[model samples]
Target: MKRSRELQEELDSDSETAGTQPTIRPVFKVTQLDSAIDDELDSFAMRCNLPPHREALAFKTYDEYEVHYNKSHTNRCLECRKNFPSEHLLNVHIEECHDPLVTVKREKGEHTYSCFVEGCERKCMTHQKRRMHLIDKHMYPKNFFFAVTRDGIDGLSAPRESPRG
Candidate 1:
């Protein structure tokens, strides 16, 4: 009842402020103290369906020591076959225990690049090889040029002779 009176006073003050700021009042009415108490009691009842003061329900033959021992002993390193002091130790063991052959068997192939020239089909295993291919097969000196000549029924065009001797 006291809480309800206090809440009513608060609502009245809020309504007074709502005249100047029409949006100040809450969209819904606040819960009455009696209903709030009832709701709390219902939630408490649901939570305490089991006895509040009683010890936790036990298994038919609960053995906590065996459970702990099994948990502590079962989590061990496969390679070392020894119980690790903690998960960090187990991770370290796994990282250190990898077989050399496994590393070799999982090796990745060397990096390679395709020639950047338009029609070139050469593949090189490194940048240096690709550069050499470009210089040897694609690049040309500035003076390099094909000479055009007039053909007079010859098999292939010969350089045009200097006009008249």
Candidate 2:
């Protein structure tokens, strides 16, 4: 979509070529769009009672949320009924303590990961294995990542995406 004249002018004003003709382009760049989405997500989280201390934090990329979630929230593990010293400690406990059974291989600078579903420890060590695992087990959007660390299966990339059942 085209940017409004005033917004375009404002953006052009910040450029090094101040006197040169401004190049009018789409108002929202990919990074800007991503930031907007993250803002919306933060708003949603806030409405859902995200703690006050976390409200001011900014998540730059969606994947960072995975890392953040893994690092934060160290209270009692609701699933395993385990208590931790702190929420952050509890989060670490969960990631380190639980074994998702997945494996990861680094070969020729490429990464090969696995799908360690219960009763089906299928290793995605090859192309065919990866496809079969995605189709037969995780039939979600193709863009989604399992977010399962090599052996630890306790963390999630997104709140909606759960560990293999």
Candidate 3:
């Protein structure tokens, strides 16, 4: 009878603690008008569960760049150093691993896409802009080669065009 009473008291104490605990809820807000391509990118990011800001999207060759333009830029996982197609996939990884050692912080900025064409100082603000520059300016093929590896090295391939970046 005494053990039963003790167990009951412990349960009651747990209930009280749970009742007193505060719940944390994620806050979401939409602000201001953005470009349609930007909106599409945002939608894609959300769908993939990736952070909004990415550091770099470098390709060895303009051909590789052409291939990756339509797809999500791959990023290296800080914890495992493995490459993922998108930040969304990385976030999913964190969740799946339930890694206490891993931490993710969202900084304010859009994903950066760079032109790997040698001496062509073309750094696009968005992937879509880069695609436009490649197709319209450089006449890259509408269909291009997509690299499967995310080695994160920028200077893997030679530039097709003269220095225009």
For model 3, the superposed segments whose C-alpha errors exceed 4 Å read 1-107, 146-165
lDDT of each: 0.42, 0.47, 0.47
Candidate 3 pairs with clashing backbones: 48-88, 49-88, 50-87, 50-88, 60-157, 120-165, 121-165, 122-165
Q: Write the per-residue lDDT of candidate 1 for residues 43-99, one digit (tens) a residue.
A: 432221122225433322236534534434544555545544344334433433454
Evaluate candidate 1 by giving its C-alpha RMSD to the native, one decimal: 32.3
RMSD of each: 32.3, 20.6, 22.2
* Tens digits of lDDT, candidate 2, 20-64: 655555555454458887767765332212332444565656566
TM-score of each: 0.20, 0.26, 0.25
Q: Model 2 scores what on Cα lDDT? A: 0.47
Clashes of each: 0, 3, 8
lDDT of 3 by residue, 1-165 (tens): 243565666667777788875443344667876688776555433222243325545455556655564333455556555544445435544433434432221123433444434445665664567667766777666553323122422333632222233
Report the Cα lDDT for residue 116, model 1: 40
Show pairs that collide, candidate 2: 74-87, 74-88, 75-87
